[model samples]
Target: MIEDPQGTVLALFAAFCRVGGCFMLLPGFSSARLPMQIRLFLAVAISMAILPLLWDTIYPRAADPVASYVRLIVFETLTGAVIGLIARYFVLGLQFAGTVLTMMIGFNAPPSPDVIEDTAENQLTNLISFAALMVLFLLDFHHVILRALVESYTTMPLGAGFNPQGALITLADTLKQTFDIMLRLASPFIVYGLLFNIAVGLVNKLAPQIPIYFISLPFLICGGLFLVYFGISSMLEIFAAAFIPVFEGR
Candidate 1:
């Protein structure tokens, strides 16, 4: 019943190239804490699942001559990588914001093992980054990304080749939007840190004999923690709400 089984296999591999590339850099799935075997199998399984839907588009190209097929592989992988990087960069921006937030609040606690990755991160930074990622997962953000990937074949068709300039522009735009949103979320703390530090400095200047800076650490931490307790819920809400627009816009 099956004719051209070779082409089917080749087409499946082609699909795998793109999906695997995206999974290679996707946030939670790409974490070092996850086993490589799981990631590979997930990528392969998704590729197979998507292949039927994209069979017509991919099959013809799958039969390309060996040299052309190699080129296709490269282009498909790069295209998928560019798409994956767009999402990855946005999450990384939030992580960067978390780092900045921790520093601003004077919560320079010793770094601990990151919950999502193998890297060590400041506890507060880890908490913020992990929470934001968790919120995205809860909101089914991966579904959005996967949907975009499927729709992308229309915009970026198979064998169309990769456009480096376009990819760069897309990535740059993602960073700009991500930075704007994260900055808004962290601005209150930034202002708090500045005003608190300024007041502490003035008090220290007047009370020369007192170790005001050392004395002020507890107040600074307490105030920062207080702000975080009240503000984190709203911050995560805003972050989750913004993901759809940011991702689709880019």
Candidate 2:
């Protein structure tokens, strides 16, 4: 049976739109403020390029006029958005860790522009978030992303349909894990602050004239800076260690 070129072209364009919309919001992919038209065309070009490559794999059989085509577009778009959101959430988790860490350490420099959300994140949050995001691409973490995207095709094929129940559960799990990981990454500062504050409070009570407030604030701030400096490397390492399993199902 000969394949319909018109159907193939329509499907491919639809796929491009779906994928491009996701990339528009995805971290690192569409980092700049490119207009939607340009972004869409870029996505379509890439999709066209890949469509030829995945012709046998992705090409759908033609059915009755109009119904399946609309379904294809909607389903593909939703799935694409879901995939992009999942990947972006992990990056947000990393950003969350940085924000919490900075807040704890008194290092936040807020109101700086953010490439991810295209507004402004706290400067410290922006730094760490950008660095972590770069690391993901540097390490070719997209390999994992692409693997998931491919697996999605097999696990939830083109016409397999959406499952609200499964999506909700997975989204909840991702958010929960994201929060847990952020806390774990920044827990050191929280612990240090807690203990240090307790000691400072006690010292103040015991020696009321010791100039504790001014004296201790500098000491506390310096101590926090030093701890963060020492812990930064380990922080990234810890994130990397825990991050793999979350997406990899390891």
Candidate 3:
């Protein structure tokens, strides 16, 4: 019943290159704890599922004898990697913001294993990043990334070479947008730390004998924790809302 089995197989592998490339760097899927076998199969399965929808586009490019199949494979992989990196960069930006927030608020607890990755991170940073990531999962943010992957065929069709300059521009834009949002989220804590430190410095200046540093640290931690408790909901809301636009390159 099937015609051109060779071409079909070639097309499927081409699809896999792209899908697998995306999953290679995708946030949750790319975590160290996720087995490579599971990642491979999921990429293959998605490639198979999407191949039919993109059959016309991928098959022609893949089946052509002169089309440099190896080149096509490389291009497809890079294209998908670029898309995945955009999302990854945004999440990394949030994690960076969490680190800044912790430093600003004086939450210098011992570093522990990250909830999502293998790296050691401040506990508060771990909490904020993990909560944000979990919220994104709950909101099904991966669905948006999938939609983008599906739509990418039209923009960067099979056999079309990867555009490094364009990809760089897109990633640069994502960083800019991500930095803006993350900075806004952490601004309150930054201001709080600045004001608190200034006051403590003045009090120390007035009372040169007292251990002002030790006295102020507890208050700093307590106030920072209180602010986090009250503001966390809004911070997560803002983070989730900004994700789609940033990922979509809007």
Best by TM-score: 3
The top-ranked prediction according to lDDT is: 3
- The C-alpha stretches of model 2 lying farther than 4 A from their native spots are 1-3, 32-38, 61-66, 108-110, 209-213
TM-score per candidate, chains pooled = 0.97, 0.85, 0.98
Candidate order by decreasing TM-score = 3, 1, 2
Predicted structure 2: lDDT: 0.71
Q: Please count the clashing residue pairs in each candidate, in the order shown.
A: 0, 0, 0
- Give the winner by TM-score: 2 or 3: 3
Least well predicted 10-residue stretch by lDDT in candidate 1: 60-69
The lowest-lDDT stretch of 10 consecutive residues in candidate 2 is 58-67
lDDT string, candidate 2, 1-250, tens digits: 6468677777576657456656765667766755667766767776776666555557653232644776777777777777777667778888877777676665645578776667878776777777777677777776676566556666766666777677667767877887888788789988887788789899999998898867877777788889877887777776666666776651
Global fold similarity of model 1 (TM-score): 0.97
Residue-by-residue lDDT tens digits, candidate 3, 47-149: 9999999889999989999999999999999999998898899889989999998998888988999888899999998888889888999999989988998
Model 1, span 76-156: residue lDDT tens: 999888878888888888888888888888999889999888889999988888999999999999999889888889999
- The predicted structure with the larger TM-score, 1 or 3, is 3
Greater lDDT among 2 and 3 belongs to 3
- lDDT value, residue 206 of candidate 2: 96
Q: Name the candidate, 1 or 3, with the larger lDDT value.
A: 3
Q: Which residues of candidate 3, in runs, are more than 4 Å off?
A: none
